[model samples]
Target: MSGDLDLELDPHAVGERVQARLDEVERAGGPAARAAADDAVRELMLLHQVALTRLLHGLTALPGTAAALPGLAADELVGGLLALYDLHPVPLADRVAAALPRVAGKLGREVALLGVDADGVAHVALTASGCGGGCGGSGAAAAEALTRAVQQAAPEVVEVRVQERAAPAPLLQIGRRDAGVPA
Candidate 1:
């Protein structure tokens, strides 16, 4: 099984090979072919693990090497990992919810949302709580401000709209609309 087949790292090519092998396995006489194919896949995964480990080790050993990689830039790599995987960093939704406590403390109430744009980017969408009225702004005005912020932060986000929920509940539904793709 270990020596039956070679594996390549190209994901698309690997997918094609798997499809072909599955077809062949389906047509094969019996247990022998299935066992061989299973062994081949296991070997391929082992090879991948070995190769990736070696690559990371080599990169880490080279002086200043990790610094030059695009996605490996210190801030992005650190921030991305922290935001996505770290336990200390609050969950994004929870962070948004926690902001509510502060707002609730101030306003003596909570807010709800009507609907947020379905097309908006998930990370940039409005959460359970929003920018407070500390700016002396109305809900519509705050929504517009948030829209402008989204536009500036991600110009690719072409449109933003929010629906305000009923009174005594400060809810806002934000929607993100993507810019049209060029024909």
Candidate 2:
């Protein structure tokens, strides 16, 4: 089991390596060879995508197997595969939304996914729920945690931007003391 067979089974690490090689090909190869390589890689990916889609459909059509998809979608490896092929039952927004609660718990503030931009950057809004959202710790840490969570949950997200939600206007309490009834 020498050679590449000895490589670890980390899908993301392998995928990154493959992407780096593709980038290198794009950079170094001639136009025609680069185009051909790109097409070949795309076609191979599409083939796997179609095959997996069919397999998932068939499995879900089975009586007992239908209930297993959500769990599969939540699993790290299977979820990553499903996400890579855009076959996950959960939407990207929902996945990002789900990660916000955990971020909120960690930051001890009310956090939410304001929206995801077209460039795959997730904009998160941090509201002043507890401690006025002004904790002494670094906001960068919160941003980093959020970025990591969203990316880990949905790799389609390319980046994360954390923003402070504007504090609500103060409520002014104005009550006439019963026309001089009491002081």
lDDT of every model, 2 decimals: 0.46, 0.81
Per-residue alpha-carbon lDDT of model 1 for 45-123, expressed as tens digits? Answer: 7776566557656876899865554344223333233332221123333433333334334433343322224453323
Residue-level lDDT of model 2, residues 1-183, one tens digit each, is 567674337777888998888778878876776788889989999999999999998998899987788787887677778989999888889989987888788777778788988888888987654455457235777778888888888888888988966556688999767875866
After superposing candidate 1, which stretches have Cα over 4 Å from the reference? 1-17, 68-183
Candidate 2: misplaced stretches above 4 Å? Answer: 1-8, 26-28, 117-119, 128-136, 166-183
Q: Show pairs that collide, candidate 2.
A: none
Model 2 poorest ten-residue lDDT run: 128-137
Give the TM-score comparing model 1 with the true structure, all chains together. 0.32
Model 1 whole-model lDDT (C-alpha atoms) = 0.46
Model 2 root-mean-square deviation: 4.2
Provide the global lDDT of candidate 2 against the true structure.
0.81
